[model samples]
Target: MNTDARSHVHALIDRLPPVQLAALETILQSMLDPLSRKLALAPIDDEPFTEEDRQAVAEADEWLKDNQPVPLENVLADFGLGMTDWETMAKTPLPEETGKRNG
Candidate 1:
């Protein structure tokens, strides 16, 4: 983390009441478990935001909010492989035919 971010966190912690500070300490310590510690140490990746993805997510959220018909299964099926067929798909070769050894 940057120096500015560290200063900001310190400022917030310094302003907390005794009870709130204890609660925050408890929550922070709980996150230090073996599995959670590994997750916390993982690097954060930045993904570029695309207009198409933003639009799709907004539409899906609106549909769910209004209790409208949302075709999630069909949308997922169009990804070409289903849950059971994922292993078979992983073993299949790519469409490109460049790599081959003719005996």
Candidate 2:
């Protein structure tokens, strides 16, 4: 690592506005986190949108308009699960989250 370059980055970060920090955070995450890097580099889906896709969206909207909203917990309870179950299946923290950004 270049100590001078790192000092320059720290200086630039210290000078950045709060609103601009989110963009910087995203850039840094994409650089250090493998998942973020992969996603950032992933090819865009360019398939043409069809009438069937529109119809399906319309049907979903109509269903939402006609039905009462169900809470996530109620739906999960039907399958003998809860939010804690989701937590157990959650992905491990990103390198940045674990302070392992050098990767």
Candidate 3:
């Protein structure tokens, strides 16, 4: 299967004219985003982070490394959740708890 796919790609490249071939090569070399608006086979976006964001990320990473747990079913139920709940939580607006908590 791999050999067949590779041969197919080679055949497509062989059929292209010199200018088109060079354009294809340029696309291959560029770190294009796949999720971008373009129809090309590269990524869409690669967001760079600020130093504060990076520091917060490092702190979160260390926290997770020290204290992650396999949550029990009862705990999930207490949070009014199922498997999809976590994914839903990700889509919601950021909570005010990140800053100073209100009484």
Candidate 4:
């Protein structure tokens, strides 16, 4: 974020009541959780891949070369699901709770 935007956010945070601050913290964490997971999973530049990782990548490449890409619609149809179903699924909460505030 730019300095101005960060300053604005800080000002807003300073004005928030304790309960609201807690809620804001929760909301921000939820927003960042996916990004944090992706970052954590991303390979480090200095780290070497294990033999298993190399084998998995090779197998995946071979499979991709051998098989034609299937249309997403066809795949979804096989499961009796459509685009709408996918959209709904994407919006639905997972079984695990993140302890988000109800309000």
Candidate 5:
């Protein structure tokens, strides 16, 4: 809890113009998200494209041309989970793991 640092950061934010402020907000919001931060920092894939990779990319491109994108909720629903289940799953212990300790 560095109040002085926070105040200084806020003061700097206050001095930014509308466009720079918007960009700063986007950058800050992205850094706060663990997945987004990892994705932003991750290096580009440099591996040579194999036949499988080429086929997969062609299939994906064809599918995109003909079909709509699948929603995250629908994908999760296929696994008997929902968008809101992530928090609960993280907090709850697995039944097999619990049994192993209790047995």
Candidate 6:
């Protein structure tokens, strides 16, 4: 941002009461949430998949086509978690848990 715009934001923040500041934080997070979710779901890179990766994905797709897909709730239950636990993790995943790829 330009210096003047940043200065204006700083001034506004300085004048906000704690409660108002908290509200502003919530508003800001709401604004950012959609973009953050999109980024999280986006592919990491534009590179073509390796042959092994392609084969693995193809196998997974074929398996899913033939077998009944497991519900997310069932999968979570296998790990002793439920919908609430998954939702909580989704909202605020740990840094180490973010952007991980499984083989």
For this target, which candidate reaches the highest lDDT against the unseen true structure? 6
Clashing residue pairs, candidate 5?
A: none
Indicate the worst ten consecutive residues by lDDT in candidate 2.
86-95
Q: Better model by lDDT, 2 or 5?
A: 2
Model 6 C-alpha lDDT per residue in residues 1-103, reported as the tens digit of each score: 9999999999999999999998888677766895565565668898887999999999999999979989999999999999999888767866655788667
The regions of model 1 sitting more than 4 angstroms off are 1-31, 68-103
Q: List residue ranges in candidate 2 displaced over 4 A.
A: 1-10, 17-20, 28-43, 92-103
Candidate ranking under TM-score, highest first, comes to 2, 6, 5, 4, 1, 3
Each model's TM-score, in the order given? 0.34, 0.53, 0.30, 0.42, 0.48, 0.50
Worst 10 residues of 4 by lDDT: 33-42
Q: Model 6, stretches more than 4 Å misplaced? A: 1-43, 46-48, 93-103
Tens digit of per-residue lDDT, candidate 4, span 1-103: 9999999999999999999999888778767776544445558889788999999999988998989878998999999999999878766655553557565
Ten-residue stretch with the least lDDT total in model 1: 89-98
Clash number for each model: 0, 0, 9, 0, 0, 0
Model 5 residue 12 CA deviation (Å) reads 3.2
TM-score attained by model 6: 0.50
Q: Which structure is stronger by lDDT: 2 or 6?
A: 6
Root mean square deviation (Cα) for candidate 3 = 12.6
Where does candidate 4 stray beyond 4 Å? 1-49, 98-103
Cα lDDT for residue 96, candidate 6: 56
The lDDT values for all models are 0.73, 0.83, 0.72, 0.81, 0.82, 0.85
lDDT by residue (1-103, candidate 3, tens digit) is 6999999999999999999999888776554533221345436568778899999989988888989755766678898887678656654445662585768
Q: Least lDDT summed over 10 consecutive residues: which range in candidate 6?
A: 34-43
